[model samples]
Every structure is written in C-alpha cells, then in structure tokens.
Target: MAPGEPAEPETAVVIATSGSTGAPKGVLLSARALTASAEATHARLGGPGQWLLATPAHYIGGLQVLVRSMLAGTTPVFLTGTGFRPDDFAAAAAQLTGGPRYTALVPTQLVRLLDDGGAGLAAARTFDAIVLGAAATTPALRERAAEAGVRIVPAYGMSETASGCVYDGVPLDGVHVDLADGRIRIAGAVLAHGYRLRPDLTADAFADGWFTTSDRGIRHDDGRIEVLGRADDMINTGGVKVSANAIERVLCAQPGVRDACVVGVADPEWGEAVVALVVPAGEPGDLRAAVRAELGPASTPKRIEFGAELPLRGPGKIDRAAVKTRLQPGSHG
Candidate 1:
C-alpha cells in the first residue's frame, strides 16, 4: 500500500499468496485477525520484545513481523544487503540492543546461520525465540539448532490463518486447531476475513469460523498437533500408503545429505512410484537402504537423484511441480 493511503477500513493487510498449486490469492486480513495473531504470539513467547524481519516483507511471515512490531510499539530490525546473507543477518542482529530478542526464519536460512560458525552463529544463540516456518523443518534441522542451544519454535500456519497460529504444535491463545477426517482445521480470532475477491474459494475453505487447511495432521492425546503432511501428499504404492515427507525427513537425517524432496511418479506396475531428489546424493544405495530400514520396503524410492539445492516457490517451499518435471521421464534432473 502507498504511504499515507490507508488500507480498506475493514482490512488491515492483503497478503498475496503465490498459490503455486493454482491461481494466486489475495488474503484479506482484518485488523482484529492481525492484532490477535500478534498478541497471541507475544503471549505464547512470554511477552514481546524485539523482532527482526529476516524474510521478504511480501510473505505472511515477514508481514507479521511488522504487525507484531507495530502492536508492541517497537521498531523491528530488517535484514541488510540483498537476499539472505549470514554476515548481513549477523550485522543486523548486532543492532538490536534490547532484551528477549526474537526473529522468524525459514529452515534454509536457519541452516545457513547454524553452518556459518561465526558471528551469525553467535548472534542466533542470543534470541529468546526464533519462529521457524514457511516450510517443513526437518528433524535434522531441529537437532542442529538444539545442539547449538538456539531456541527454535517450529510454527504451523498459513496466510489463510493470518500467519503461524500453532507454535511448537500448540495453538496460540484463543486459537483452536482440530482435525476432521485427518485434515487439519483452524478457528480463531487470527483467521483472515477471506480471499479479497474469491468468495467461491473462501466458502470452500472457510466456514463456521473454521479455515480448513490442505495439510493433514494427527491430534496427539496430549493435546499437541502433529502435521503428517499434505492430505494429497500420501503416496499409494503396491496398496500401501506412505508419506513422502516421512521419507524426506529420514533422508535429511542421514550423513552428507543437506536436503531432500520426495514425490510420486507414474509407474505402470505400482501406479505411483516413490521418487526422491536429494542434495549431495550421498551413496544412493546406502541412503535407500536406510530409508527401507526406517519406513519399510514399499516406502523406498524407486529412483534417487542428487542436486546442489532444491528449487523454491514462496519463501522456502520446495517447488514440487518443478521437481516433478525435472525428475520426469526424459527430462534433465
């Protein structure tokens, strides 16, 4: 929005989602939803302090940084330099001269900082909380951050819910997370008004104050929610169901593997074969064996390809469609 030109009175922010799976969407967030999200976050984080905006301002996670800062009456620190540079992040960190410093980052950015082993690493450890979202944070990443003593809170939410409503598997204050037939649904003061001009999509997604998410999850007995993966991401092979995200996590946990993206490919016999693209593709046979041992034979990838890095869509989401095309028959992967 242009400076001094206020947003519609009913809408505080209209975040445009990339909507990689379909057409893009403009999520209209009311001042109430935005404020509730920011306030609930502070309550969960033991009260707000300073927040650094590391991701792009266009994305929901980054937009909330500004919202949270406004609600707290504090100036948020922005990352310096073009793109995300560890050195630049560290330099920005040095500028926050306050207590209980906080920031949000994607898993890729967090991985870079932990690997920096310099000022960036030192700077990251000082934050009271670091909200990690915008992609599935693998167990390996969590382990790395924990070993370094950095407080990492894995958040689960989207633009439809006004940002991260579930932090570390627990819903924020006044927010409710549930599962209907295995699909995750959220209802709270944090929900966006609806898509700016797409009522059909809005009606299908939101109802009775609940915003249904594409991702499927398990509500643990302890009142914690465990997102299994996207509902459609379950791969059916040889009559057995398997989670591609499961394989990805297991692959990333292996030695010499930096990242992993698994997808189902067409196979005459199995219908949809499990295929994986790994970063640094270390010992494909051994990696396959490890996966077989962890998740069983049917879950093993029919093929594995190595890459320097994974393609991204919005924030740090792996470009699934791009990965599928590259790994498809006859195309260069």
Candidate 2:
C-alpha cells in the first residue's frame, strides 16, 4: 500500500458500493483497469499534476486519489478532519501550493458547499475539477456548481471498474461501457476479477470478463451514459414501468423539493403504484404540486409522504432500501 511498492500488480481492489439497493457488495478492481481509467482521465483533463484527498482511504474513490498522486510522482494533500465539510475541504485545498488541485465528493457534499455560499462556495470554485460519485447528481446541483465557476465532473463507476471510468459526462479512455438488457455492463482490463467469496453472486454478476452492474443505464448517441437507477428499484404499476430514479430526478428539479425518493406500494387495483417519499423545503404540499406539474400525470407520484430528511450512508448517498423499510406498512411515517 506504500508508494511504488509494486504489490501483485493489484488485479483487484475492494470497494463497498453503497447499499442503496439492498446490501453493499465489495467489488474487485484490476491494476490495468485502474491505470487505464486514470490515463483516460488525465488525457482529457490535461494530465494529473497534484491531487487533494478529501475522501476516506477505505473507499475506492479515496484510494484512487492516492493512486493518481503516486502515479504522478506527487504526494496528495489530505483532509485531516473528523468528517466531510465545506470548510475543512476548502482549508485542505488552500494548503496546496503547486499545480491544479482536484478532489472528489458526493452530491450531498456538493449541496452543502453550494448552500454555504461565502468561503465554502468560493473555495469550491477554486478547484480544477470537483469529481462527484457514489450517487446520481441532481440537475439543480450541476447548474449551481457551474454558476459558482467550479469545473464539475459527474462520475459513474463502481469498485469493479477501478473507481471511475467516466468523467464530466464522458466515458474514460479505452473503456467499453455499454448496456445489456437494461443493466450497465463494463468491459476492459479495469473490470474486476470477481467477488471475494460469493461464487454464486459473482457468477450472476460477471460474464465473459465483463462486469454487469445492477444499475440500469442507457448509452446515448453522444457516448454519454445515463444511469436509470438500480434495476431492482423499478416500480411496475398496472403494466406501466416507472423508474424511481428518473422520477426522483424530475422531482428534485422542482423548487422546494429538497430530497426525493419514489417507492412501490402494493395496491389492489394497480398491483403496485409509484409513491413518493420526499424531504420538502418547509412546504411539502406546495412542493408536491410543483413535482406533479413538472412530471405530469404518469410520472407523478400517487401520494407524497414527507420526511425531515432522506436517509444517508457513507458520504451523501441515500439509503433507498432503508428508506423503503421506513415507509413499510407499519413503520413510522
């Protein structure tokens, strides 16, 4: 784990994909795949110079920050703090004195930074690139980041792909990313070998050297991947397929809708109807009307439930399954 240690060529590294779906899985990554992905990122971003590490070393994204720094022959600046905050991250970046400094963060952190405004937002704008991962980025956040003069790159990758192979809405170099049967499949040297000790799960997840992710995606003509939430998160209502993530994205775009989640509830008529559990901004009912107006009838939720806040894991990812359990028949509202 030291700099230039040359340990086993790193065929795979385990990263805990957030348990937003059900259970988190430790994804194995390869050295070649990781390197290829890094190279691709550098090629597009004008090569790696110096990096600022704000994430935990245990996470794949955090580990890749170290890898990139070592590969560039530079030591990265670390964020020595209790937990993630805009002030701490900005202070860490301010300490760096060399080339362009880059850091990775989850969407929740980005929201906090945007909300902080003054020094935090100013510091956030100073970075060469602010990479976002772990969960989907809201359209509102993306716009806010741009207006703040910060260059933002939204990433889509798991531990199996060696952290991330897509940057700024574009796929990394030499990585073959595609969608098969609604599942996101990645093929390349960066693909993981298999799961640690679950052969059955591994067999179901991997095929012919390509790692199949549980998340659904669509590769647009521009070669950008549009992730459509997890496959298991889909809700089938009266023969109509509704994507919780897709609807959530639209709902989150509405004003006063702080956080949004779409879930399937058993219904005698439709079998299952799409219901929304939202974290509203002081006015839940008004936000619900806005969401309805935005997505229209089909995508609109049959009912909107309010929560003070959405459940979160690690950094800023919503624990969808946990939220589902909270919304269970007898659970607290």
Candidate 3:
C-alpha cells in the first residue's frame, strides 16, 4: 500500500525498510499509529510547511509528506508525473507562494539538484529547511548545502520511528533518545505502538518502554547520537566484527566514488570477507589507493567493482542483494 493512504481503522499495512542487508520486513503500521506519527512529525517540523513530494509516496518519506501536509492544512505539490529534472523541481518549488515551504529529499535528490547547477542550487537554497533522510548525509554534501545557505538538517530514524524522530542526529522535541548496548532506543508520542503480526519481533525490539532500533549507536558527549550501522550488517571476520556502513563511509569519502556499498562474502577460513561495490566518479583505480591510504588494509575491500551506479531501492540506498549477485561465481556461495 502506498504511504499516507487512508489505512483501515486498525488494519495492517506492509512498509518495507531499505533492505540493504537482508530481506525487507513487511512492517504493519496501524491507522492510529500512523495518525499519531504524522501529527507528531507535523508538530515537530513547525506545523506542516509546504511540502515538495519528490520521493515515492509508497515509502514512509513520501507518505509522511502527504500526511504532514494534510495536518498542516496545505496540499503538497506532487513532483511525480511532473518529471524529475532539477529544473522541474525548481519551477515547482518557486511556485510555492504559501506558508513556510519545506521539502523532504533523499541524499541523491539533493546531490542531483546541486549537480544540475545553475538555478537548481539557487532554488534549493531557498527552503525553510531541506531535510536529508533515508541515508547518511556525507560531510561533503552537508558542507555544500550549508555553503549554499540551505538549512540542511541530517535526519535519523527509520520505518519504525515514523520516518525521522531525530534531526541532525539529535532527538526531536518530546522524543526520548537513549543508547543501550550500543543500539539506539527511542520512546515518545512519535514512537509507533508496535509492529503488527510480529509480536515476537515487537517484544524483542521494544523493551522497557523504548523501541530498540537495529542501528548501533552511541550518545555523543554533546548529547547527539550517531548511528554506526545496522547490527545485522556487521561482519565477523577472524573474531572481529567490522561495520559495513563504517567501511562504506570511508570508501565514499574518496574522489570519483559517488557511492559505496560494503558487504561480507562468506569465506571458508575467515568466515566472511569484505567486498565493496563502488559507483565510480572517474577511475576505479584511483579509489583503491585512496582506500588503502584512508581505511587501511583490513577494512579495504577485497574486491571492488565499478559501475554506472549502485542498485537502489525506493530511496536511493544501495541494493546489497543486487551487488552480491554481481560477484564472481562461487565468491558468495
């Protein structure tokens, strides 16, 4: 079911997470929880600013935009069926002459706007705030957007917490953030009741009145939380658990690598070996030296594949399954 659609009073709906690691779990969000989440998000985002609908409405990001607009008493400008060019977005965003204009964009959309250049960057600079969600916002992207004078807030949350309960890695107003055993724990009005049809998962996930996130994180000394990566994505090679997202972060920092996805390949001895799928900006070879210099040998990918772009799901996150499929025969088996 598409996000923001009027769900049955207490009926179950399936919502897919990014599914970068394993299978996508069909999360059942009730209408009540959905309503509560939308209302809470609207309240936190300063009461339903004008929304530019870029991401697919089937995803939570798109669904929340519609719900937030409804709560704010405004209609979101649909970018779908209108084309996805930066100029198209600029024209639409420019035409928004209503209450505080805001838009939710994934990192790729934001980057595309910047790359489209000309009026595109200028257009993006004019939002009340441009929220970056679904994936980690690189320092480079953040710096560029900030330089362009955009209020670029890096958001944190997932399908469970109703999109994002944290902005700039900090918990939203009225939301409680805690770290237990390096996992992110959240509790507040914004939190969903529980996942439907998965009572065992609900019990295991929500503990002590707080929903425990799959992300491994730590509360900073300054009170902000940094999500390290998904607990399941960790690869234990020779008794060492290496974070795939952590490795991707380092690899993505190199020039010519527009994107990076690190995964663990089964090995007879080490149990798992790290392999990287890179979307090259220029030359794939240049990234190898950069990885060696920056991430060191252990973290350096045993194999690197350059391609047009990484396979992405609804929100432009790397599709790890597709990446694994690209490996040499018998590499993963």
Best by TM-score: 1
- Tens digit of lDDT per residue, candidate 1, span 233-266? 8889988999998898888889888899999888
Superposition error at 8 for model 3 (Å): 9.1
Q: Estimate each model's TM-score.
A: 0.94, 0.89, 0.87
Model 3 clash count equals 1
Off by over 4 Å in 1: 1-9, 281-285
TM-score of 1: 0.94
- Which residue pairs in model 2 clash with each other? 11-30, 12-29, 13-29, 33-190
| Candidate 1 displacement at residue 317 in angstroms | 1.1
Off by over 4 Å in 2: 1-12, 267-270, 282-298
Candidate 3 — worst ten consecutive residues by lDDT sum?
1-10
Highest lDDT, which number?
Answer: 1
For lDDT, candidate 1 versus 2, the one ahead is 1
- Output the lDDT of residue 214, model 1: 92
Which parts of model 3 are misplaced by more than 4 Å?
A: 1-14, 30-47, 283-289, 292-295, 328-333
- Could you give candidate 2's per-residue lDDT for residues 243-299 as a string of tens digits? 788789877877777778888877788778777788776554455566567756556
